[model samples]
Target: MAADRGARLGFGLAASVLAADVATKAAIVAWVEYGARHEWLPILNIVHVLNRGAAFSFLHDAGGWQRFFFIAIALAASVFLAILMRRPGSSQPERMAFGLILGGALANMFDRIGRGAVVDWIDFHWGAHHWPAFNVADIGITVGAALIVFHELFGRRRVSEVNG
Candidate 1:
């Protein structure tokens, strides 16, 4: 029963996040030309950029094999996350966290396969310093990871109060 609930929660969150991420990417690409920026806030802008590599453009200069490498990694992680989500007795929060990460990973993998690169548009900068521009998919993954960490640090303590 718990497994079923977790599976449903996981799939639902994953699908919703994937849809939002894809839709936003499409809209951004349609409205903004590549490498162009539109400042929406003093510290934020929307810029269309293609990242052909991993985080921070790691391996971006490597011939072309990095694409396949990342694809395989995403594929494996998606499978593992799905398995974890459906594991018997898993909590809803755990499943939801996996869902978000799964959605983001799959979304980026789709970009890697279809566009040959991920489309990123959100940009944040501080005066002379700039942070990597990422998309909604990245947010999903980051937030999901943070939730998992929070569960580990605090959520489990609450659970222990009930079980232990």
Candidate 2:
């Protein structure tokens, strides 16, 4: 009973986050266009940019090959994450981390495969220094990665104290 509830919690978080990511991307596509910039802060702006490749825009201009490569990579990642989630004794935090990563990856993968690119909008810049434009799924993966680190650090401390 408890295990079922735990699984649901992880899956629920994943579904919500993934849906939010996809919906936000759809909104961005509906509203923003390439090179159209809207400033939210002196250092932050929303400018639609479609990423046709992987992280750091790798192979962004590989004609059409990048599409298949990226889709395959995302599929592989999702499968790997599912296996990790099913591992015996996986804790809630671990599951949540995997869920976030999987959801985010799948969201972007769907866009890349269906649209041939991923929509990116949030832009950060400071005095000519710029960070890559990214969308909600990117944010999800980043936050999820941070949470994994948090879990590893604090989770270990708690376990040691309890067993000590």
Candidate 3:
């Protein structure tokens, strides 16, 4: 029963993240012209850019094969995450982490299928340096990965202490 409840919670969170990611990307496409940038703050800008490759735009200019490659990876990751979320031993945090990663992967996969690239808009910069532009899907993936790392570092220790 706990496992079932955890699955439901994970699925629900995944759905919410997916919905938000899709909506935000759609809005960016509709409102921001391709290659155009709008200053949002001293350190931020809203822009429309298409990434045809993996994170940090790796292989973005490597012809066009990277698109399908990334889609395949996302699909694989989504399947793995779904399986992890359904594991009976998975705690709530672990389930949530898997859900977030699954949602982000699915969102990016859909973009690769429908748009031929991932739409990135959020930009952060300081002076002459700039961070790679990313979207909501990236946020979910990053945060989820961080959560998993945090749990691995601290959660296990706490559990062991309690058992002792």
Model 3 alpha-carbon drift over 4 Å, by segment: none
**Full-model lDDT, candidate 3:** 0.92
Q: Is candidate 2 or candidate 3 better by lDDT?
A: 3
Ranking by TM-score: 3, 1, 2
Q: Tell me, by TM-score, which candidate is best.
A: 3
Error of 3 at 147 (Å): 0.3
- Candidate 3 is scored at a TM of 0.97
Mark the 10 consecutive residues where model 2 has the least summed lDDT: 1-10
lDDT for each residue of candidate 1 in 1-164, tens digit (9 for 90 to 100): 76897899998999988999899999988888889998899999999999989888888888889999999999999999999998886788999999999999999999999999999988999986889989988998999999999999999999999999
For model 1, name the residue pairs that clash: none
- Provide the clashing-pair count of each candidate structure: 0, 0, 0
Predictions in order: lDDT: 0.91, 0.83, 0.92
**lDDT leader:** 3
Residue 12 in candidate 3 has what lDDT?
87
